[model samples]
Target chain A: MILDPDLPLIDRILAGEQNVFAELINRHKQYAYTIAVKILQNRPEAEEAAQDAFIKAYQNLAGFNRQARFSTWLYRIVFNTSISYKRKNNKVFQSIENTVIVYNHEGEVSLEKTDKTRYLNQAMMKLNEADRTALTLFYLDEFSLDEIADITGMQANTVKVRIHRARQRLADELKILLNHEALTL
Target chain B: MNRLSQAQEDILLEYLDGTLAAPAKIKLEEELRVNALLRLRLDELRAVHTIFQHASLAEPSRDFTARVMQKLDTAPSPTPSRWPIRNAIFLLIGVLTAIGAAALLIASGVFDGSTSISLNDSSLPQKIIQQEIPVFTFSGKLIINIIIMLNIVVGWILLDRAILRPYFQRRMQA
Candidate 1:
């Protein structure tokens, strides 16, 4: 049975049950890791950021206002922690302008499945950080635009615009790759 | 045909994702049927959306969970000590109580009177006057008077050192 982390885990953690903290970690680790990876884009750093986020969550558990959902609060921590990790490492997020459109060198017009997937991944990596985050939350996590806005601390309309722009950019990049391969062929 | 506005494009994307409401979905479908450019844009967006949906989920390192658990194990356990605000309040009340008690005692003449008494046995009237009202001196008095004054001052100093100073220090710390 899938455990309902929102119910007993929060109450137990607040009641000084330290072991329950581990349960909280186990339950939200994937969600936290996904957010961290989306922002930081590196597995090790994402792991570190996720761990730090959990520690901060544990430390500030007493101050958590129950008005917001626990998952919302936790996502806020994960997002902030990932941003801080990026800042500390001095790694500039891959911006849309800086994206390199890699194409297959051989003059092959037909697209292989792997090449299309690679092209798509590369295009995703080129998107603006906000767009990338919005798309990841919306498509991969199956979050609604409202939920994406909540996690991203942006308006729903803003998230909608971002996702639209990101999709357009991806399509444009794919078209460019496809044309470049066609020319070579 | 008017080009699809950014909002309309967003609606189309949402419709493709099956997130649009029924009325909005119908409206967008009607528009898509008439607008060739909007149809092309919708197809492109659908292609990108499909790719995004199928993108590989990046798995964390092999030791990801173990590392996270280890970090939690090593993290400083929240000590859950008494809140500084509560401690400060308790110390403030204690200091205020000590000050109030001291003020009450000083105002009530508990420590204001002298310790030594002078007696005049030479004349009956003087003796009666001395008996009726004693002329007291806290300084240059009898041994017992000096001892009593010393004891009062010593007691006050001890109380200030043992209680008042510590209370104030604790309040400041808080």
Candidate 2:
């Protein structure tokens, strides 16, 4: 028999072990939060979405099929939760003008680093929902194309194209922020 | 538009990242030698990829894990007592087992023993002789009655195992 962690975790859950659920939450919270933050672009909302997803996952643990990886199933829940949160919050796309950009300067390197991160975050915010999600799952979370496809319910080819397009858009946005029109193509 | 073939561009990007195999690397190098635009595009993508790769991983709130578990703890779940179907089935099985056992005892003549008072109009001596006969007789009927009682007990045991045990087990497991 395969000693899969998810299987044992499910068994433990069925055996009236609630701590196993907690262990699962801790184990996958970072990845879940990364995806949520990338989509919602707000710390509080992302954290809330991640929490909701884990709770929902626990409630529906018995319905989990072993055919799919536990992480993939969790990703689906996180994605749906974040999207639902975004809708419920009535957050609409406004212009990207309010976005702040940070640049590196010679003196006070720490402030410059903080500013750059802020600018990167703002740039990330400017991306569309799908692009942001694709970029985060592929680059930040280090998910493979197939895994992204499983999570997003998209084809592998579609995931690849989305990542490519998202990267291109981010590069364009970054260039605009930097005042450098240096794209080779 | 004039552009590099998609395959060639993909290979070029992979090669710049040093992710291409040796054969693919040699092939891409040959192609890059013949194409200047492809080389420029590859370099641009590489620069962008490098920058993005260095982007920091956003740290969530300090109490992220605690907050998540806390939320889970507070989420409302449906009450276990709301399952009327399960309870109804259990009740139905219990009643049926009781009825079936009673019917079996009646069918096997276990409860057919007579309880009657016969007044003898005879003299005192005759009455004494009649009293000598045992009032509660135990013959083959005793064994049959014992067997019928044993069957009912077994039925009760089966009912407990089949219906009640699983329900309690599920509750405990929950």
Candidate 3:
């Protein structure tokens, strides 16, 4: 139980120690903001959405299942909230202006950008919402397929398929964007 | 691609993730030892996995947690309300009374003339009918023009994000 602070914090919060929620907020805010930013693609809206998700979770604390990982449950709330907020707010069309379409390591590509993180971020923008979310959870956070399934409301095997397809699609995208043969970097 | 089937890739991924069953693991390992294409495919999968693993985790703005806490502090308490029906009735009554009052005021010619409240109503109409527009000085005009320019710039950016950029992106991709 000491390994997972969420259990104790949850108990304390349920026991009327409301401030114990600050600890939970601190623990999870980065990931919440990360997912929101990925979906919203706008910093201020993502931050607001993440904050709203936290307050929503706190209000609905009793609905949280103790058996599930708090991160997974919280991420689900953030993902859904951000996606809906985006649907309501972001009627924006995406541009591939920042993109460079290179196929798998055929030639020297223009990846002279300082960081692959920026490159990766731009590449991710090209994917649909679902694929980006799935890939972010699976690869970035290392959530298990089952946990991702639970969070994304898909079955475990369905999650596996989604992740697999996302990887292929991402790889294809990166190949085009980075013009690298393999994702060796 | 590779000489790999999608199902085989799935198995390879599960195997790489160490989620594959022991039997499948054993069979895949046996195959990997002698099969070069399978090994190459495995490497490719591993590279993708590695790149994903190394991808950056985003941090929020510095005050993100503090801001969330601040908002939570301002938000309504999570406890269920004790007299929700009473609160709802009071709310409805307040809304209806406000609406009724507005209707009464309007019917009594409030907006037009009778109940209209103004500190300098006498000069307003005379100035409006007799001049080249009223109440805007040079500074006011400059400020208004600046505001209009700002709105146009913001609108253009929004329009680009919402419509033009996406249309062009789709066109470029197509």
Candidate 4:
């Protein structure tokens, strides 16, 4: 039968091949962690949330209907778990000045890129969690609008609006941040 | 240059995403040719896109996958029937015990009209003030009734938490 690769693994797991689940975990962990980090904005918490999500996926494997791709379902779990962690922690964003970005001994362009990346991260913190997550998944170029809607529990139209609005706001924030930097120097 | 409207900015974004229809794309291109401000806005949005293109996924710790596998091995299967069923059994037992005790007390006549407690019956208040305090007497039957009512409420809550909610959650998932 023609099934997505994950469906076979899922069938095997359902048939009592438990260790086969590890391959599933390895296949999906990066995007899962990325979704977590985007929502939680804390590396340690994101890691914990991602790990918890994988465990949750494993536990609920029996109930996973194959209507959606496995990655979509798993990322939804990651998104929800990260959101719950974010709520539990109620963490404030770290100050931009305190953020550290390390690059190898490249040239001045790398230094400038690092600074821009740092400023972008700071600008991202200014957004509310939903907006940050919406923009992040949009830019990741991995999921379609429908998949993003499923992951974030937003409507497709809403996700579209949010992505545009978030991008516009990020542009404004980046402009302000760069202008402030120029003034300080 | 005049500030662009929100609609205008949305059009620019749509154009950038290449989702603008051919007619609208032609119209926007015509506008961009004459309008420096719209072009400038497009450039700013393009810059944001460029920055995002440079963005990459943050890698989890080296052991992230291993950690997930380890956790999967150790964590119990989150079946609605397993832990929640056990918890429901314990709560049911507790509720049954409470109802049984209340029934036993009632059958033994411990809550009969003759048995009661009074606040003024204590000697400490009289020893301190040597005055007749207002007597607040409650019958054992009343206290037992209140206790039973409270137990019923608490038992309902426990049963809901332990059983009904989990059962329905699994049903919805299915």
Candidate 5:
């Protein structure tokens, strides 16, 4: 059987050792935030949503059945929280400006890298939230299709289609952007 | 050299992901050798895939864990507690007991028109109380009816609190 590191921490929290939950939060915060950011596309809102999701996970610690991995459960919570936050706030697509790849002023390599990153970000923002999130999670290489499906509340086949479609759209957008850059150059 | 079909694109994606079987990979490679447009499309898809491959997890603010812990200190526990329902039930019982006592009083004729005391027959002087106390001629039945109505309202609210609200909330969660 596969061993889960978070299982022990979860048990401690369930047994009333509340402080250990901090370690659990720290361990999973990056991924949880990643999921939130993928869905919300806004850093501050994504942060809030991720924190709320952690608090929710903590509160519902006792109800967490160990059948699923802790990360999966936490991500699902993050996904739902971010989606609800998006709906409740009625936020327009906010740029994930902070998470963009930083460009070094080295030479032509850096310039092309920067352009590709910018094009990818713009293209990502153009797709609907589900497609963007699915593509992000799939390419993050941190989750399987099934885990992504669980986090997204979609069937695995649906997620596959979404990722496929999203990638195609991103390629099309990047082609236009790069072609424009080539023309300008 | 025309635009690739959806199936061809999917196959190229699977090839890029290293999931295409050997025969399909061989077939795709042969097509790519002959078709410049198809190869260009693959190059475009590869670039997009590379961008995603470089996508890193976004970290939260430096004090995110601290903020979450602070919030947790104030947030209520997540276990579905029955205490509110229990408290409502206790309150309903108290209200019912009060209504029952009022009903008993009605049954015992305590509020009957003939049962009031007179101030003129008191130990105090007439100068202190110039007028005799009027008999309480208000109908006992009316008082009972008002009490019953109030009790019904209270009972409905308590039932909603103790039962219906929790039930519906659970249903919504489910």
Candidate 6:
């Protein structure tokens, strides 16, 4: 992918135009929040963690190496910040029984909603955090294994292995969760 | 529908993801042409890949940006004149002063021969006509006064940088 055009705005913000940082936040907040929610599996905490990550990126913008993709760097922060948030709020780790897979807003799911989607969501929640994150990043189709490795601090081949194993596990989970229903896919 | 063996899974995954090198891809393709089970396995993995590729992502709250901006507004601006620079200066002065004081103590032979400084019969020969040592004489009261002043200055800096600075920083984070 081409370098974010917002990199210049980042330069401006680092030079002390703090208000301009709002644009960066607006640009990345959705995927950042999506990443956090995928890991934390909670909407509010994901929102807070994403916010915290942006705040941290703002604080450390001066130290951010320019050669790296800004999204790679920012997503790394989101990933790490969400992990810390998870650790700090360890009590929030609960059974996935209550968490519903969200597809757009509640009423916007006409085309996207299906039994297959529901089963896949259930299977995803059953996967461990690392596997879930690996699968999510892989499925997002926005990052290569190397970029995913950078974001998650794993080696590229390790990321490949992880995605491979996680995919297998997710497939196994979907098969087990859906039983005969999986044949429809 | 079942788990693939570690080796088989790795090859198949690499092939499915198009990450298999040309040689490996050629090998897997050759195997797939003859191996019906391998073809079925590949088809299974392909289906799984499709589902994961289409996995739904979560959406952020409508005001995520505004909430973040509000948090940024309230977050403490890192204090002006970040203490790291000031702390380095303080450490340099502290270390140099400590070294100077140590060298003086060693040169005086305070820790060598005897614990006491009895000028009575020591090899510290007296000058026949004692030249005044310096412009300012070293006396007990003067050393004590100097030490007290040094302690006060060091105390203030320690309080500011170590104690007070961290306490306020904790409060800011809270």
For lDDT, the strongest prediction is 5
Give the alpha carbon lDDT tens digit for every residue of B30-145 in model 6.
99999887887787678688776676667788888888788888665422344664685577568557646755775675534333343444455576535433233345544544
Q: Candidate 5: lDDT of A129?
A: 67
Put down candidate 5 lDDT per residue, A52-165, tens digits, no spaces.
999999888866755567888898898889889988876343322323422221233545545688678867867876677778788888789988888888999999878888
- Candidate 2 per-residue lDDT over residues B74-164, each given as its tens digit: 7654122325545655755675676677667778887777553434433557736755443454444455556657766665665665567
Fill in the DockQ of model 4: 0.24
DockQ of each: 0.13, 0.12, 0.17, 0.24, 0.28, 0.20
Whole-model lDDT values for every prediction: 0.69, 0.67, 0.69, 0.78, 0.80, 0.72
Pick by lDDT: 4 or 5, better one: 5
Give model 6's TM-score versus the native structure: 0.63
Model 1: CAPRI class: incorrect
Query: After superposing candidate 3, which stretches have Cα over 4 Å from the reference?
Result: A1-4, A14-16, A65-67, A93-110, A113-120, A140-142, A178-185, B1-3, B21-36, B80-174
lDDT of 2: 0.67
Residue B60 Cα positional deviation in candidate 1, in Å, after optimal superposition: 2.2
Pairs in steric clash, model 3: A92-B162, A102-A176, A104-A181, A105-A180, A105-A181
Query: Which of the predicted structures, 1 or 5, would earn the higher DockQ when compared with the native?
Result: 5
Model 2 stretches with alpha carbons more than 4 Å out: A1-3, A92-123, A140-142, A179-185, B1-8, B16-22, B76-174
| Candidate 4 Cα deviation (angstroms), residue B63 | 1.5
Question: Model 3, B66-124: lDDT tens per residue?
Answer: 77777777766565333643454455555445555555655675454322333343566
Score residue A175 of candidate 4 by CA lDDT.
Answer: 82
> What ranges in model 4 sit over 4 Å off?
A1-3, A91-114, B77-174
True contacts kept of each: 0.31, 0.24, 0.48, 0.58, 0.72, 0.45
**Model 6, which residues run further than 4 Å from truth?**
A1-4, A95-114, A180-185, B1-4, B78-174
What DockQ results for candidate 2?
Answer: 0.12
| Model 1 regions more than 4 Å off | A1-4, A91-114, A141-144, B1-4, B21-24, B55-57, B79-174
- Per-candidate iRMS values, in order, are 8.2, 5.6, 10.9, 4.8, 5.8, 7.0
Identify the superior model by DockQ, candidate 2 or candidate 4: 4
C-alpha lDDT (0 to 100) for residue A10 of candidate 3: 71
Candidate numbers, best DockQ first, in rank order:
5, 4, 6, 3, 1, 2
Where does the lowest 10-residue lDDT sum fall in candidate 5 chain B? B165-174
